[model samples]
Target: DHGSQYVSDVFQDEIAFLGIKSSPSYVREPQGNGIAERFVRTLKENLLWVRHFDTVEELRLALLEFKETYNREWIVGRHGYKTPAQVRKEQTAPVSIAA
Candidate 1:
């Protein structure tokens, strides 16, 4: 689903050309896309709200660090307190091993 920024004509055209389905969440219906909203809130609270960088390079570096830490260290309640990386590893574990 496209967020508010994707309401632009360029984004709509791109999605249309790609044949990707686009659905916008209804106004005042946060539960419709709760995961995305939660992610946005976390990003704002943890990264955007905490720092002010003068240069794009600085911001990029900070964002990279934030993403790495979030994936590797952050314990998400939704995943039973496991980091996202751990959940992905568990999901991809081999069912059978060769002798």
Candidate 2:
């Protein structure tokens, strides 16, 4: 799957040369890319929806803050109220294998 930026000839060529398969969701099928769409909506609603910025730098800083908070503090219902970083840490923790 490719973002709009990845649709460029250079990206397509690189993926092709690497023997990687690439496909884009059909324009009208939001469900095909539901997870990404949902994230965008969440970001807008929780971070960008009520803010106004005069410069790209300001927007960048705001996004950085938003991402840090979202990853470290925001409780997501999907993860049983754990923050994304917490859930990721739990998932990646080492597991002992029984002999």
**Per-model TM-score versus the true fold:** 0.66, 0.66
What is the per-residue lDDT of model 1 for residues 1-99, given as tens digits with 9 covering 90 to 100?
A: 456568988888999999987888777877768888898899999999989999999998999999999999999998999999999999999898789
Please name the candidate that would achieve the greatest TM-score relative to the true structure. 1
Q: Which candidate achieves the best lDDT against the true structure?
A: 1
C-alpha positional error of residue 76 in candidate 2 after TM-score superposition, expressed in Å: 1.6
Candidate 1 pairs with clashing backbones:
none
User: What TM-score does candidate 2 reach?
Assistant: 0.66
Q: List candidate 1 segments past 4 Å from native.
A: 2-32, 97-99
Q: Give a tens-digit lDDT track for model 2, residues 1-99.
A: 456668998988999999999877777777668766888999999878889999999999999999998899989887899999999999999998999
Q: After superposition, how far is residue 85 of candidate 2 from its true place, in Å?
A: 0.7
Q: Global lDDT for candidate 2? A: 0.88
lDDT of 2 at 35: 65
Q: How close is candidate 1 to the true structure, as a TM-score?
A: 0.66
lDDT of 1: 0.89
